[model samples]
Target chain A: MHHLRTALLGVCLLSPLGAHAYSVYVSSEKDNSITVVDGETLEVRQVVPVGQRPRGIALSKDGESLYVCTSDEDHIEVLDLKSLKVDHTLPSGPDPELLALGPQGRFLYVANEDDNMVTVVDVDKRTKVIEIQVGVEPEGMGVSPDGKWLVNTSETTNMAHFIDLSTHEVVGNVLVDQRPRVAQFTPDSRQVWVSSEIGGTVSVIDVAKREKVHVITFAIPGMRKELIQPVGIRITDDGSRAFIALGPAARVAVVDTKTFEVEKYLLVGQRVWNLAFAPDQSRMFTTNGVSNDMSVVDMERLKVLKSIPVGRLPWGVVVGP
Target chain B: MNPAMSRSSDWIRILASLSLILSIGLVRAEPLSIPIGLISAERAEYIPLSSLEPRIEDEGLEGARQGILDNNTTGRFTGQSFDLLPVTLTSDQSPSDVVRDLIQRGVRLFLVDLPAADLLELADLPEAGDALLFNIGAMDDDLRTQGCRSNLLHTVPSRAMRADALAQYLAWKRWMRWFLVVGPLPEDRAFGAAIERAAKRFGAKIVVQKPWTFKAGASRTDSGHFNEQQLANSFTQVEDYDILLVADEADAFGAYLNYRTYRPRPIGGTQGLVATAWSGVTEQWGATQFQRRFLERTGRFMTPRDYAAWLAVRSIGEAATRTQTGEVSRLRQYLLGPDFKLAAFKGVPLSFRDWNGQMRQPILIVSPRILVSVSPQEGFLHQFSTLDTLGYDRPETECSIR
Candidate 1:
């Protein structure tokens, strides 16, 4: 099926400007490098060596700088998008695992797993703003689209902490399932989806009421429930569809946002950890840690197009325009 | 209307309003306190054969402390507080006396790290009738079966569970034949019996069974390697087998069988590759952060005993947080109920088996350097949870806790 799609696209690619040329950056945890693939061609473009235990990659607002969380080094390495070189370091607290940008992309919220605190960094000024004390082993960070709230999910504490951006205080705490790994807010900021890796459920919390409105569960026939660990959630901009990376299950669950039900499960590489979307949202890229590869999925068809080999322990990924 | 009647009514209303305010103030002044007692009896320390194993002084206690820290992190939001009151008993001290004192001090939750005998003694104490006890050290299968106590819940995996976990993995790898070597200790024989049971349960065959009668020489002596090598080779000269299963719970000769066997067969059970609830080699499913936190707190690798103790305390914490009460009966009911599940970085939510009071958890199969696999292995199905395949299931449970 992938070959047939490629052949059809080959005939349509006669025009030079037929597709968008975005770059996908994947942070390899073991190799200490970033695997950059061309989004248009779906091929490995470069492997840029970075700091130790690089994870949690995110593109800047202007898409000029890419922030990489060097967890072992205890800092965020800023890579220049064009040069693919480390520009400088930002002071992140100990063992930063996952990160998110503020609505304006002026500040970065990093979940410091070791310290149980979320460190907010002023990206432009390259200075620490303040460290907000959160639950134990904070790993997920999500900023509300309206810029009013930031949700950080702590894996051990098993709670989604809603922080008020204005005061930077935990305004509300909603207990989710066990080992909550990722938090993603809806495009309209009405609800936030939190994935519990060990509990094997995704909790959808209402923003206004600060309560769990519904829980979306995944069930692939013949798959053990323990293997279906939900992690690394990506919701579309229109809030119509959501893709959840099921770790160790080696599948991405596509959910219909309106119904909060699983639409389909697309099989991918082994141990898919995190994912990214192209600038145009037409393609998706997933980092498979055990396979040491990135799986490219066509957004419209919800099909895995190909698996491109990457560095060892591919962890986090992001796309740059 | 009479003035005297109106003044009497006003006085009643004022007193009622004042009492309401006082009750509200009292409620605001105190949070629900869940005090857990950790009672451990001191035992003779055995020097580990390998330098990789560090001698930890506060094994179970440190894990309970970390559990308190984790519980309080979530408790701060739920208007609850958790405290661990630990008492380590000397050889001369009595566990019954400790339980009496703790019960008098209003501790209804206990994490017991004593041997099976001492644990049973504490549970039988009249003062502990209302207390809920969690066994963190003992692994005797009989405790979960014929010797089961209605009040006792076990966090440590039983001998049968560990044996069954290993058997499942071996069956998955098609290593169906095992050469069994049993040590002289009673605990070793019990473990050997469990292996026999597991072999029958998992469709494996024990090709040859031999008892290890050679008394180990002074291992620390300069020329000890010569004696150790000969002893390991002499007893392991049996017929060909897929693996050598050693039952050495006392750490006597299990480590010696590695690389010194007559054949090049892999060693398993209490030796080369171990089936345990936790290990240093486990780093998946967010366990790296769990290990890092433990190392940062104790400056040592978390052991199996530590993980068990942590689970015991966290189970209570989880129950308290969910039920919003510290009452012994209510908490116990909530724990054994269907809604109780605690995550211990094992890639699954662990809960108690209502039939046997044993925790349903996946067992880790690990070597000295890396994790081999986790069981219940694939295709080992249970009507309820696949984790049940690693231990005694409901139908096989001899415990009847009403």
Candidate 2:
């Protein structure tokens, strides 16, 4: 049973079909390109050009399709992993920054940074179906697995807008720290952690009760809030740990999920912005902006194992099974 | 030695070693002391030498420097210190040259008040990659558009930044119709062109363009001087223009067009509805401390040049505080990080464009006596700040500085 569990966890990603089908995808806001790296080799494989000022990336739950939000394009590009071809474009809100797929994989929620609106698109149809207006500069979005709550963050207001998936109505509003971006839920959906990029803190909120339970502030001071701006947040599949991308620190912070405490810092390349973990859970990769590289971390040791030079200003990453 | 005594001595040695190791551990655990560098011109520019024996000018730079000093002091109780290195250079020197020279001096954060070409020159030098340039001057609107560079960060308001401010208020006032009056001087023409661009960008109309000619306290052979009624009657044919925009940069005619017009209308030029780099009224509204510091330090009034100088120094402090290292490379990383933002007296925070390295923030509008308003209006908002809405939107930007 022990071997079986390990095999299920590790071999799931080593499958013959999923292999070579999709490389690691990352978005570069500076170069306006998406870099793909071979998951197994951890080597930069290809660089594909995209719309003006590309920023956010989202892979379909099935891992066959990936969606990229271009800030200047006012549209989302859908890519088919099998053919590695640009599938189509869907009209999006202006200046899209971050996005996520709904639990059912039927819809994509795009955070339009400039328009202060969240655009919802039906993935199958590749069409924008609904536009929900939020606060100023709406960015970073996540939906509960049960499709009960849709939470989005407003950077300027430093608050989270929570809407009911069923009613499509704003359920409640909770103030987080300053300039909140990027959010993630625990495996069981018991908690939601949102990274306040400008505030340099992460607010871990209770999903069921919809309130902030704890705020993880970096112990160091004098570091500009920009240096502590937390851009990415990810929880382990087992919900035992969480990882946050520290923008100016150029590294990833490991937090123990149970204690809600920052456990350690794993140094990456320069200006680490966003990251993703391999499906096997053996490694995690981050896009380093200034260094123009991708940092591969050996998760077991909680250290940056290697750095892969990539296209200019690598800002987003998504790993596929 | 006795056996018991020898054992005691050995224990003491071990304790000493342990204590040494523990102290080292404590030092590492404590917060780090970081160094920051402020790079500017080691020499000054000749700006027509307005005042006698004028060595210091730049009020805007002074305001920015004071803002950083005040903000960084907040970190003292929290354990952060700031050190500034003041540099000034002549126009003959290259900005990249100065930037490299400062890197050798342990300077990595740069605040710039230079020509755009000089700013782009930062990319040519070998060590230029190591430092961050905070742009505080050279208000060409194109810097945020086609001329953007990643190595440079802008804090000083661009011409468009100010124009956007003017547009927002004008739009709110429903002053859609405009009567364009242009002066001949370069400064006058440039300002008028910017105002015209803003008029179009914010849904305004240009009913007519009137050319004004004056020799600065001298005119034609006629005996008439500062003819208010004749100048006002120039607009008699077109009663359609709502606001008369004078672009008399030479202060030749625009200064008097206000209220002296044939009809009761708003006159905006070098006088009414004007845009400038820095305003004296800025002394109020959180700008008092900046004024105080400049007066205390230099015993003179602050100028726009001073604001640029201050922003240069402050950018270094911000970068140094974040990376907690005096090293140039680390400072660059921290300075460009998305979380890296700067707050100035302009009442908003400025952040760098990772692609272009332009500091994006608000631009203030000042009437002769008061700070009238800020651009993009309160309602115009972006994901970052509503103040950003006034400047170039990401989608409209053509700066491909990656």
Candidate 3:
């Protein structure tokens, strides 16, 4: 809109120090590069060329560095958060698509899409400590609230494997609906919700017994569960609300955490992919892969307030300090 | 004394035989060494279907192994000896290791059963010059698309080629509208996307898409699972849809969507209207001899995969046979050239695309029960056979190495 014409010149002239202390990294799957954006300014600052196809991005908790798994490269690249230089590299299991970092960023759990295993990396040592076998084509991974259990979702097998964090062995498994993509536990850590992208439902399981107690399905007539394709679900820190990036339909669905009901759909950019919340959970950012842009959803207003242009096929987005 | 004399005679005969064997082996063992390189996945110790519920005719890797042996015997009978040098790749290993191992073994061709990227890695390698790759199981259309390589020859049809064959016959039936039910897997969607493309090209519209969810342990009692009553009451309302297109490539729940389809609709995508290579009825048009020979050799029915294996050997034989000049370079040139064609009984004479090395053939749309139709409808035409209409042609392909 050229609304920031004067402000842009001021920023270009270095009139004020950038307030964007935290950087947002968008892994562009199509273009095969990582676009670094200033979270506050929403300006695409730099593009870092990486491997063949970059899908997942995770920042170190202390904001010292970032890790990206380029699927085709078959390795994870470590980028210094301040210098934005690829400093260290570590071997990951093949075709890593999603990553779940342990609490305090000591260990990184990577879901290798092609291998059907989860690689546990000691980030400090820059080495893979152990790789635990999981279900077929593990697509999503999440650590428990207390970081006791690492849940990895296998898309084809339609199951969630619970790995004991200390032992790094698959302790248990819970069968869910078809194409389960993401695994997340509620704030209380009593329940684990696994989203089935194709099965068109989320299976909420009891963490203790590892049994599925509830299956959540949407009743949007004329839309097939396979096509509805839920991916990258984020529940609020308070655990009252959840936002799911629904594929093909190009919308972010808001769900009531307690009721497990889809409350509403927030129209986002095309192919609304992975999303991340602001530190306070006041806003949500999604990388719209098809439209090559980012959709900024105001969580308080429950609406997509703006769409910012990005690189080709913005896949995984990260919002953190 | 007579027994000792007899024993001494026996030793003389044995000694003479041993000398003869030693002298004969020296010449016979001279290095006319034939080398064959095999690229396969890690050896699997446990088999699910075979271990859990063994079938009279298996459907898993065991079946593939048996089919390979059947075709290998045929190759052996023709005097082409293959010593398998199998290199297994795990999720952690680098694929370039395969290229190096094959080179060390003096392997000129590779029977590749790896992912597309791994195949590409070998093709792109500078040291992998003059090496030919035969794709056994990569069904991704993109491998035939932008990733096509000159040195690679696909024995398996691209996913779209097989999917489109089924769609065309259904379209001919005036199945103007389809209720496209796709599976959740990305691979299925990729194949389904090709079907969707074919449907649009043939003037069929997907009116509604529904995904049936099958939970792992939530097996409904057959008391209500699929009976006449269940089928009739499966869907309360099916709107504007005449046929169902199921695209579950994993076969996870697709088999159920076929005849059990609610609302009296026909299944098209994965189940009812299927396009494939080398169906048993494909023998109807003089393929009877092929079916007989294959069946007799294996003592089992032929699968689509078995045909690909057969075609790979036959293509090489046909190329070698047709070339009167017995030069290895000339034979290789004939196969890699654009003009070479083989009568694989897949329908019209098939040839390699040269660009990505995928075979072009008329796909047979058939079911386990019967043959439905042939794709590249009678009137449709391409420079090659209408089968070229199934997958990417020269202009649209992104394969760079070719």
Q: lDDT by residue for model 2 over B1-402, one digit each (tens)?
A: 999999999999667534433432322334344434444554444433122435555444455556455434422322344555545666576666666777787665666655677766774466866656667766667777877765666766666666667777878888888888887877667777778878878788888887766443433436554564465566434667777877775455565566767777887756687655465567422355445556776677666556655655555655554554556666666666765655445533456555555566555567767878765574654665565656566677876554
Q: How close is candidate 3 to the true structure, as a TM-score?
A: 0.49
Model 2 agreement with the true structure over A1-321: per-residue lDDT tens digits: 123235445645676773553368988877877888987777777778788878788887666667888877888887776676778887776667788877877888888765557888887887788877565557779887666778898664455777667656555556676567777877777778898765678998898777899999775443333346688887877789899888767768899988888888887887788878876678899888889888889899887778988888787898763
Please identify model 3 stretches exceeding 4 Å from their true place: A1-18, A221-225, B1-402
List, for all models, the DockQ compared with the true complex.
0.34, 0.02, 0.01
Q: Give the DockQ ranking, best first.
A: 1, 2, 3
Q: For candidate 2, give the lDDT of residue B155.
A: 63
Arranged by TM-score with the best first, the candidates are 1, 3, 2
- lDDT per residue for candidate 3 within B242-323, as digits (tens), equals 8777887655555555555557666666656677876666644225444655555556667766566555544554454345
lDDT of 2 at A147: 69
The lDDT values for all models are: 0.88, 0.68, 0.68
Specify the CAPRI tier of model 1: acceptable
Best of the two (1, 3) by TM-score: 1
Q: Which residue pairs collide in model 3, if any?
A: B146-B398, B146-B399, B283-B287
Model 2 chain B worst lDDT run, 10 consecutive residues: B70-79
Give the CA lDDT, 0 to 100, for residue A121 in model 1: 99
Scored by TM-score, the top model is 1
